[model samples]
Target: MTKTITAVGFNFDEKQSEMIEKKLQRVSYAEEHIIDLIVRVKHEKEYSFDIVANFRWGVQANVKAEDFDFGAALNKVMDVLDQKIKKEKEKVQQH
Candidate 1:
């Protein structure tokens, strides 16, 4: 069965929240097995974002980034998480 992926937005306006949700949906594929995702955004002089991706196996991957805008920070965090997940999968395959 395909896993359920949930994306949460914190301190985000309607437009930003919708944008983030759509961006996350791009990664919500069957092979990812991401059961849930908690996306927290903090806006200040410097924006900060934290993404917690929960897997069915109880493995939670987290990524954080800071930038001038919350959306940019979120994108950076997503990029990091993408690489992190890829590396983790490679490790698992090698074992």
Candidate 2:
């Protein structure tokens, strides 16, 4: 799967990037079914994350989460993303 991570309003260091990569690994099982996985992070008064999962079968799932803490926001977003992906996978399997 093609993965892209973009950060706005701040620079992400290697450690932060690595942390994101590790978090993303949780969804690696769906790599073949997913076409593109895009994650956008923005920081202002709080940390916000937007994740989009484009499936190979023309389904798209978008999830968003925000928190005052970076790790919390990331975890929240990923958890939702995981659920969305699982739901989509089930749909694909049923068809």
Best by lDDT: 2
* Candidate 1 positional error at 76, Å: 0.6
Which residue pairs of candidate 1 clash? Answer: none
RMSD in angstroms, candidate 2?
Answer: 0.6
Candidate 2, superposed: residue stretches over 4 Å from native? none
Error of 2 at 56 (Å): 0.5
C-alpha lDDT values of all predictions: 0.68, 0.95
lDDT of 2 by residue, 1-95 (tens): 99999999998889879889999999999999999999999999999999999999998999999999889999999999999999999998998
- Relative to the true structure, candidate 1 has a C-alpha RMSD (angstroms) of 3.7
Give, for candidate 1, the lowest lDDT window spanning 10 residues. Answer: 1-10
Location of the lowest summed lDDT over 10 successive residues in candidate 2:
11-20
Q: Per-residue lDDT for 1-95 in model 1, tens only?
A: 23223334335568876777677666655245666667666665677777777766667788889999767777888788788667666766686
lDDT of 2: 0.95
Residue 90, candidate 2: C-alpha displacement in angstroms: 0.4
